[model samples]
Structures are given as C-alpha cells and as structure tokens.
Target chain A: MLIIGEKINSTRQRINRALISKDSHYIQQVAVDQVANGAQVLDVNCGINIKNEPELMSWLVRIVQEKVKVSLVIDSPNPDALEAGLKVHQGSAIVNSITAEKNRYEKILPLVKKYQAKVIALTIDEKGMPRTARERFDLAKKLVKVTAEHGIPAKDVYIDSLVHPVSTEPQQVTEFLEALRLIKTLPDVQTICGLSNVSFGLPNRSLLNATFVAMVLCSGLDAAIIDPTDKSIRSAIKAAEALLNRDQYCASYIAAHRESKL
Target chain B: MIDPKQIAENLINGQAPKVKELVEQALKDGLTPGQILKEGLIEGMNVVGTRFKANEFYIPEVLVAARAMHAGMDILKPLLAKSGDKPTVKFMIGTVKGDLHDIGKNLVGMMMEGAGFEVIDVGIDVSPEKFVEAVKEKKPHVVGMSALLTTTMPSIKTSIEALKSAGVRDKTKILIGGAPITENFAQEVGADGYAPDAASAVDKARELLQQR
Candidate 1:
C-alpha cells in the first residue's frame, strides 16, 4: 500500500505553530523522519494562516523536497495554495483532493490538469458526505468519470471513500469497507482513506485505527493517508500484508523485523 | 405522578419518544412548559454537553441526545410561545464564504439549540453580503461563523468587515470558530468571542450575551 505521510499538516497544534513561526528546520525534520520511516509520499498542508498559505505552501514544498526524495501530496482547499505548492514541487506531486462539489471540482480540476499531478478525489458533493456504501460508490464513479473527461486517467485518480467516525456512526466502517470493495470494481482507479478518522471520538484510538487499517487492506485499500511514524500501525500494515499474501514470502515483514532489531 | 427528573433521564438516554411522552405527561399533570424545559430538556442536554466536553460522550451520543431534546421541545414550543416564554437568545450561524464544510457548525447549532437558543442556520458557503443581510433581517443576538479550511478562514474576517460597513456589527455579538480558527485569530478579526469546540461554543455564546 502507498503510505502518504500525514504529519506535516498544519491542523495539528505543533505543526500549526511551526508553520506560523516559519520554522524550516522543524518542518524539514518531520519530512525526513516520515520518509525514513517508510513514507513514499508526504502530504504537506500549510493551511494555518489563510493570508500566508500561498507563501507558506511554496516555502514548505521547497524546504521539504530539499530534505527528502519522495514525491509530495499538496493538500489544500485553496486553489491558490495548491498552485503555489505545485509551482515549486519537484516530482509529479499528488493533489490531496478534488471533490464533486461543482465549484470545488471546477476550481481544482484545471489545476490538476495544468500541473499534470495525480489527484485524490473525495466522495463528497454539494450535499455533503455520503452516508452509505451506495452513496460513496456513486460519488466515486462520478469522480472517476469526471476526472477522466478532464484528461486525468483512472490510474492517476485516487478515490477516498471518506471515512466517518465509527464512534459516531457505528456502521460507518462496514459502509467504508463495502465502498472500498465496490470502488475496486471500477476500472483501474486506486482507493485511499485517512485512517484516524475512523477512530475519532473513541478511546484506545490507536487500537481501533490499526485494526481498521487491517480491515480496509483486506478490502483492497491501495493507499492510506496516515501517520507513517506510528509503530503499531506500521506493524499492523506489514502483518496484514503478509497475512493477506500481498507480501512475497513475507519478505517485507522479515525485513521490517530485522530493521527493528537493528 | 410524572417526575421531571425521569424526563431528564430519558432525554439523556436518547429515548426521544419516551422524552416526548414524559413531557406530555408532565404538562398534563399540571407542570408548566417552562418547568419541563428547564428541569427536563435543558437539564438533560446540559449533561450531554458536559459529557461531550469531558470526552465521555461522542458526537453520536450528543446528536442522539439532541434529537431527544428536540422531541420534548416540540411538545412545549407552542405552549411556551403562547405563554410568552420563547427562547430568549437568537443565534444565527453559517459557514463563511468559499467554505462548504458544516459539520462543526451543525454541532454548535444543535448545542446552542439545546441550550435554549433559537438558532437560524444560514447554511454553508455563505458570503459576507448574505451575513450582513441576515444580521439586518434576523436581528439575532449572536452571529457565529465557521470555516474548516485555512483558505476559507479569511472569509470570516471579510464577513465581519461587511457587517461593520453595513453598521450591523454592533447589533450582534460575533463568534468565530472552526478547525483553523484560534482565539487570537478571533481577536485579530475583531470578533466578540471564539470557542475551540461545539460545547464551548454554547458557553461562549451565553457568556457573550451576558456581557452585552
């Protein structure tokens, strides 16, 4: 599975403070650490100060890329910030999201096409979040068709079923897993989710999150926006992959074990 | 024989039908609508809000409890209005322009309703002009703005500015919040109050009104 490091997002208090203070060293260390811990892509979000987002996004894109070799996921709701980050981002970056909301889709798709970036398409529209597997699948299908029409291929489109808090909506996990299975039936599009949202408002969140990750992997999740530095979650991913026979002869699991021992 | 405490307990447990039934029973047994509202619905929702803040109750629980509160409110609303016991404070809420997110805003609206405020949700992607127009028409005691994205956060200030230019800024207390909003940001934007979460939004709304 592709692991998108979610640590550099400015929503967290520390990251928000760092971004506001222009702490380049703190931001770079986080990027380097995630990549070292097995993140192949880092999601950089500098949405702390709206007025400074464009400047901060580009600055973050530049500084983080200077320290790491991985591709990036420019996560922002602001088209300006996305463009600013894309302008400076070196590899083929992944745009964090494009939703089916008419205005958002119109505003973000051209940027994705212009930048030739892979895109994460969320199952949301003007009506807000989908409440069932059918709703999610329908939105996913629409996103795939729309992005394809916009000249972005299905393979480059990542469909996020949008995990709701299972604590709030107990059936949400079942619905999410079902949606993932249904989404895989679509032609060549990838499936991803933010792991922590499933465990929101629940105690022993890490336990719920790790277990949910295993469940989604079993349901054919291709990628996850997650804290790559979470040891338990990493172990869960490796173990699940090995158990599901996605790992060849459990080689990746053995390598992980050896590295941990070292 | 209807006990208001029983009504409160049923509301807390999210038994909407039971809460309504008990409120009806309380009224039929000579309890005032005000008494049932205070000792039953509001009393129950206060526990819900406190538990939510303490991490004991999550969104599902709070939402369910709010539904129960609404069920009881339906029984008392007409009677209260007839008796000139309408909810004292009116709150108008919306997600600022360019932001379509409303989960947080909805939560605050529900909590405020539970706290006995008459809430008018102007919905998401509300422009500054819409805010100014609503402030003029609704004449709400407090105006709350929400923005989940850092990109949309500036719209809060813009809306406040619009209200100021329209000369309606002082007519209502402005409260700002969302994932990206901070107390400092609220102050910088010249808002009257800021709350980090939905439960506190209720307290802040009450506190802001009291200061008026």
Candidate 2:
C-alpha cells in the first residue's frame, strides 16, 4: 500500500508553530522521520495562515525534499498554494485533493494536468459530502470520467472514498468500505483514505485506526493517508498485507519482524 | 401493567416508538413524569453512556438511543414543567466562530440533554459577542464552547473574555471542548473544564458544576 505521511500538516499545533517560526529543522526532521517510518510520500499542508500559505508551502516543499528523496502530496484547498508548492517540488507530486464541486474541480484539475502529477479526488460535490456508498460511488465515477477527459489516466487518479467518523456516523464505515469495493471496479484506478478520520471523537483512537486500516485493506484500499509513526497502524498494514497474500510469501512481514527486534 | 424496565430496554435498543409508547403507558398507569424519566429514559441513557465510554456503543447507537430518549421526553416535558420538575443544570453550547464543524458540539449537547441537563445549543460559527449575548439571555449554569480547528481554537478564549467583559463570567462555568482542545489549553484560556469527547464532556461539566 502507498503510505502518505500525514504528520507535517499545519492543522497540527506543533506543525503550525513550526511553520509560523519557519523552523526548517523541525519540518525536515518530521519529513525524514515519516520517510524512515515507511511513508513513501509526504503530504505537506500549510493552510493555517491562508495569506502566508503560498510562501510556507513552497518553503516546506523545499526543506522536506532536501532532507528526503521521496515525492510529496501538496495538500491545500487554495489553488495559489498548490501552484506554489508544485513550482518548487522536485519530483512529480500528488495534488492532495480536488472535489466534484464545480469551482474546486475547475481550479485544481488544470494544475494537475499542467504539472503532470497524480491527483487525489474526493467523493464530494457542490451538494456537499455524499452519505451513502452509492452516492460516493456515483461521485467517484464522475470524478474518474472528468479527470480522464482532462487527459489524466485512470491509473494516475486516486479516489478517496472520504471516511467519515464512525463515532458520529456509525453506518458510515460500512458505507465507505462498500464505496471502496465499488471504486475498485473502475478499471486501473487506485483507492485511498485518511485513516484517522474513522476514529475521530472516540476513545482508543489508535486501536480503532489500526483496525479500520485492516478492514479498509480487505476492502481493496490501495493507499492511506496516515500517521506512519504509529507502530500499531504500521503493524496492522503489514499483517493485513500478509494475510491478503499481497506480501510476496510474507517476506515483508518477516523482514519487519526482524527489523523490530533490532 | 406498564414497566419502566421495558421502557429502559426499548430505549437501549433505540426503539423510539416503543419508548414513547411505554412512557405514555407508564404516565396513564399513574406514574409521575419524574419517576418514569429517572427510572426509564435516564436509566437507559446512563447505560448507553457507560457502553459508549467502554467502546461497546458507538456514536450512531448513542445517537439513536438519544433520539429515543427525546421521543420519551417530548411526552413528559410539558407535564414535568407544570409539576415544577425542573432539571438542575442549564447548559449553553456553541461552536466558536470561523469553525463550522459541530458534530462534536452536537454530540456533547445530546449527551448533556440525555443526562437531564437543559441544553441550549446556540449553533455553529458563533461569534464571541453572540456567546456573551446567549449567556446573558439564557442565564445557563454552564457555557460550553467548541472549536474543531487549531486556528479557530483561540476563539474559545476570546469568547470567555467576552463573557467576563459582559459581567456574566462569574455566573456560569466555562467548559470548552473539540478535537483540538486540551486540558492545558482549557487552563490557558481560563476555562473551568475541558473534555476530550462528548461522553467525557458530560462528566467534566458535572464535575465543574459541582465545584461551585
């Protein structure tokens, strides 16, 4: 599974303080640690200060790339910040999201095409977040079709089924899993989710998150936006991958076990 | 022949219609609204809260059970008011300005209501001035603020300051919560209490109120 590191986002208090102070060392350390902990891609977001986001996004993109060789997921709702990060980003980055909302779709897609980058498309529209699996699937199909029309291949598009918190919406986890299964049927497209969202407003969040990771893996999730630093979640993914026969003869699992011992 | 235990069971299962029916039957069978509320609806919700804290009952189950409790309350409220059976605590809650997220706030409100607190939800994106105005007008025993984003969290402090300026700060206990809020932040903002989640919010509010 593709692991996108979610730790460097500015919504987190530590990251927000670090961003405001332009603490390159702190940002670089977090980037390096996420990569070390098994994040194949880092998602950098600096949306806390909307006015300074463009500068901060580019600065973060540069500092993180300097410390880590992996690609990034430039995360921002602001088009200017997306462009700013994309401009300085060394590798082909993934645009963290575009929705089915007409204004957002129009604004973000051109940047994806312009940068020749992968894109995460959320199953949302002008009407707001879809509540049912069928609604999410319908939006997923629409997103795939539109991105395809924009010359982006299905393989390059990542459909995020948008995991709502199970604490508030109990039936949503089932709906999200069903949406993942449906989204998988769309030829060559990948599926991703923000793993922590499912456990919001609940106790034992990491346990819930790890369990949800395994469940989503079973439902055909290809990537996850997650805190790679959490050992339980990392172990859960490895265990799930081994059980699903995705890890070649359980080689990854056995290697991970040995690595933990060291 | 109406049994409060049956009402509690129906409520625990989120059988709203059954709960309402049992409540009506219990009332007609000469039980006071207070007796039915304490033994039936609140009793069931207390179990729901415990299960929720234990992670056996999730948000949806609690929500439906709260809905069932509300169904029973709708029948008993008027009669309870006429009989001078008032809930001891009045709670006023709102999501702070520039943050529209309210699931946490709403959950806290529902849990408070289920716990027999008179909850006055001022809704989301509420300004500091608006909170001050509500606290003055509602004259609640406790004022709760919620902010889902780190950026919006500072508004909780601002609202508290507004309450102080409006001379209502001493009248109400200030309780703050949200995904981004912590006990340390609560202290930094001069809040009387902080809860990490809705279930705990009720406990924290009760603890704060008891300190007074």
What are the lDDT figures for the candidates, one per model? 0.90, 0.89
Backbone clashes in candidate 1 total: 0
What candidate 2 keeps of the native contacts, as a fraction, is 0.33
Candidates, DockQ: 0.46, 0.27
Kindly report which residue stretches of model 1 are placed more than 4 angstroms away from their true locations once superposed. A101-115, A126-128, A169-172, A257-262
TM-score of 1: 0.91
Model 2: residues with Cα > 4 Å off, grouped in runs:
A201-203, B1-68, B81-102, B115-177, B181-212
Per-residue lDDT over B1-212 for candidate 1, one digit per residue giving the tens place of the 0 to 100 score: 89889988998899999998999899999999999999888888888888899988888788889899999998899999999999999999999997867678888998898888899999999999999999999999999999987778889989999999999999999999998788988999999999988989999998999999
Range of the 10 consecutive residues with the lowest summed lDDT in candidate 2 chain B: B148-157
RMSD of each: 2.6, 5.4
Candidate 1 clashing pairs, residues 3+ apart or interchain: none
For residue B169, give model 1's deviation from the true position in Å: 1.9
Best by TM-score: 1
Per-residue lDDT tens digits of candidate 1, residues A113-178? Answer: 999999999999887788899999999999999998889999999999888777557887899899
The docking quality of candidate 2, as DockQ, is 0.27
Q: For candidate 1, what's the RMSD?
A: 2.6
